[model samples]
Target: MTEMTYRQALHDTLREELLRDENVMLIGEEIGIFDGSYKITAGLLKEFGARRVRDAPISEEGFTGAAMLGLRPVVEIMTINFSLLALDQIVNHAAKIHGMFGGQLGVPMVIRTPGGGGQQLGASHSQNIELYYAFVPGMKVVAPSTPADAKALLMASIRDDDPVLFLENLALYNTKGDVPDHVEPAEIGKAKVTRTGKDLTLIGYSRMALVAQQVADRLAESEGLDIEVVDLRSLRPLDRDTVIESVKKTNAAVVLEDDWLTYGIGAEVAASISDGAFDYLDAPVRRVAMAEVPLPYAKPLETAALPSIDDVVNAVHETLDAVGRRR
Candidate 1:
């Protein structure tokens, strides 16, 4: 086991996957010569040559569309906000092609982008848009939390037959974790139970999972609350079985998402848990998410707009209160 930064883990995964699969190719802005904006594709251009790891111009929509023509293209948009500029290609061509063409055509493409607001990148660049791509029917939106998840799911995403939107939180790039050298790809739609408990379940994705762990620790230390934490790694094609299974055991839930509260991934998971695990529920399904609005540029206001440790802690307390399980 070796500790590696989140960005290095992803870069290693891409390099490893490309070496493993001959069909895997990459195309995006600054990916080859510039070594990617975050250096996630660093050194690939030198090793694999320009054929496999090629760079594109400023056209996010155009090059991305061209890259998804059939090959398993790993197109890395500089930022998630920039992906909206290429929405037409992702939605119409890459996403809709497989199902639309009666399985004749394939869209084994992975479009990776950075998101979330804690970096003070302002409203446009820092917003979490995981739910936006999750809303699309044919796309698999993956927002991995740990270095392991980032590495494993990226390889999985590259190999997926459907279009997979891999959202890497910009703030998570420098975060370090122990990564296994002989790790295999994890399934896209499966949810992992990060921390096991009998009291309540805290569901989160991406960087929010780190915050969830911190929130879980405080609950266990101070309130003696044992919380089951689920990392909803794949937002779309959500692992309903995993979440429903947890809700069945705990009977209480608090979903923590970094996106807006109105129609965030938390809302979807909450609704599903209610539908599938209704009889087991002892308290109302509580959701702690970002405030619904454009992210503020000011540090304090930006921090306020983003989901925090306090929100998760308070939500857990409220959930326990509702269930008469507060200690």
Candidate 2:
């Protein structure tokens, strides 16, 4: 095992994959000389040279569509907000190529971009619009909250024979965790139960997944609650069974998300729980999410607009109260 920051894990994994596969290459604006906005590709340009680690013009649509015909391309959009500019290529081309050609061809591409608030980047740059791509049928969206998952999932996304939207929440970049020395590629459509308990389940993805664990720990220590936590690592495939099973065992649930509450990912999860485990539920499912407004630039306003530990804790408490399960 190796302890490293999330940025380091992604950097090392990208380097490793580039070395392992001759056909694998990277594409995106400023990825070559600038080392990427997040520096995940730092030194990669020097090591692999421009052909493999090519920098691109400031055109998301143009560069995103430049995936090599028979090669795996790891494209990085400067930020998730900028991915909107490339939606045509992402949704119409990369996603539909395989089915559009009746399975003769496929787009083995990975689009990596970061999203999330708390950096005070304002609404335009700090939005979590993953649902836009995840809404499409052909894209696989995976958001990793830790360094280990970041490494494993990236490896899997690169090798998979489909377009994968690899979401790297901005807040997790500097966070550190231990990664396996020889990690296997993660199964793309699976959800991981990071914590197991008998009380109500706390479910989330990406940044919220990490927040769920922290909230679960705090509740365990303070309220003497045994809360189960499910990390929805893959948003699109969304392992409903895992979420359903956890809610069944706990008889209640509280969902957390970095996106706004209206029709957000949490709504889908709440629906899945209701569909598969309605009989087991003791109370209405609760959700804690970002305020339904364009995020403000002020740090305090941005912090308030985004979901927080207090919001999650309050939701958990309310759910437990409704079920008469609070200790």
Candidate 3:
């Protein structure tokens, strides 16, 4: 095992995939020359040349539409917000091609973009709009919270025969974790059990998954609460069974999400728990989500708008209280 930051893991995995498959190519603005906005594709241009690490104009729709046609293209939109420009191509053409054509053709492409607030990029740039792509039927969405899963999931996304929306959290770029020296591609639709506890189930994905673990550990130390954490690795083909099973065991749940509460991923999760494990639930599922307004540019306001560890902790406490479990 090798400990590395999430950025390094993603870079290494992209490099490894490029070497392993000749068909795998990266296409995006500034990816080749400027080395990407977050530097995830740094130095790849010199290593692979212009043909493989191709750079396009700053046009999301044009590049996205072009990249989807052929090759196993990893199209990196500057941010998830910019992805909106290519929504028509992504939702109408890329996503529906396989199903619309009777499975004769498939878009083996990957749209990799970073989202979420932290650097004060303001409301327009720092939005966590993953729910948009994950809502589409033909798109496969994967968000990895740890460096290890980042590598594994990226490898899997690159190799898959479907169009994948690879969600990266800006806050997690520097986070460090152990990654296997020899890793296998993670099963795309699976959820991971990061921690086990009997008191309540804490579920999240992407950045919030890391937050869930933090809350679990903090509560374990302070309140002696056994909190089980379920990380939803894939959002579209959400592993509802894993979530339901965890909630069934714990009999209570608190969902943490970086997106807004209205029709957010957490809402889907809470509904899943209600549908699958209604009889097992000891209390109504609680959801902790970002403030409904657009994320603020000011650091303090942005911090206040986004969901924090305190929000999750408080939700857990309230859920436990409702269940008659005083922690």
Candidate 4:
């Protein structure tokens, strides 16, 4: 019932989960005395002691693989760009250890990292690696868009049996929203519709959902389009049912995404709509996404690459116009 920043909610969840489970331990850069780069683990070291809240050196691959040897390590990279350093451990060991060893052991680990662009942190640190991780087997990918989702999903990931890639956007750290103390464990592969409507469905992930919500409000006021907005907090094993059901009722859809359009999660959602909800479709599904270029460093070029609220509005209008033309 209290409001908290997404970062605070995450920190609270980590502390609570640690209190609930002794097997859980965290290892990452600056997570201990420094309280994490984003302060998500602030004050945790004081509460749990140094053994639990470890500060690994800059070697992500070494510490990540070593942590997976036994303890249920929660490896939090300061940024997702640094995750590439541990890709071998992630792709080879964490992802394949149990399967390769014929179920002798399971890597009960959680890899947390920050992603996405908007803070002008430049192009190097802003890539959304969800689509890449979704390609690998034996790994679960999650992205929480709200304070509630951030807390609940991270708690669930901590208790999960397999290795999980939990990605938080750098841009969402300061975003404030309501979260309850008595939160339940959220299922990892599910989706939630933040706002319901009958005209059209707007699917978005992470920060893009906020963008779509803004566009949804404008569409209702200006264009009379009662658009439904779906917040897909989980990326891998996605909650396809929520999206399919919304599109069935609305008869049209527009996907808003911040990643490059090619092979992005939005493309997967669009394909599923065409395959599963083809009969209910009134118009071709459209997506508003980043352009296919290495994210630019300059402000103007970066702004042009990313989708905006206006882009979502235009996509909705285009879908409706095409639907009308069919008659």
**In candidate 2, what are the lDDT values of residues 1-327, reduced to their tens digit?**
989999999999999999999889999888889888888999999999998998998898988875538889999999999999999999988889888888898899999999999998889999999999889998999999999999999999999999999999999999999998999999998999999999999999999999999999999999899999999999988899999999989999999999999999999999999999999999999999999999999988888899999999999999999978899
lDDT of 2 at 114: 97
TM-score, one value per model: 0.97, 0.99, 0.98, 0.96
73-175, model 4: which lDDT tens digit per residue?
A: 8889878888888899999888898899888889989999998887777778878777878888888999899999999999999998888999898778899
Per-residue lDDT tens digits of candidate 3, residues 1-327? 999999999999999999999989999989998998889999999999998999999789898875445589999998999999999989999999999999988999999999999888989998989999989999999999999999999999999999999999999999999998999999999999999999999999999999999999999999899999999999988999999999989999999899999999999998999999999998999999999998899999999999999999889888888868965
Question: Local distance difference test, per candidate?
Answer: 0.88, 0.93, 0.93, 0.87
Indicate whether candidate 1 or candidate 4 has the larger TM-score: 1
Give the C-alpha miss distance for residue 253 in model 3, angstroms.
Answer: 0.2
**Candidate 2 CA-lDDT value:** 0.93
147: Cα error in model 3, Å: 0.5
Give the lDDT ranking, best first: 2, 3, 1, 4
Compared with the true structure, the alpha-carbon lDDT of candidate 4 equals 0.87
Check candidate 1 and list the clashing pairs: none
Candidate 2 residue spans exceeding 4 A from truth: none
What CA root-mean-square deviation does each model show from the true structure? Answer: 1.3, 0.8, 0.9, 1.8
Model 4 stretches with alpha carbons more than 4 Å out: 67-69, 325-327
Off by over 4 Å in 3: 67-70
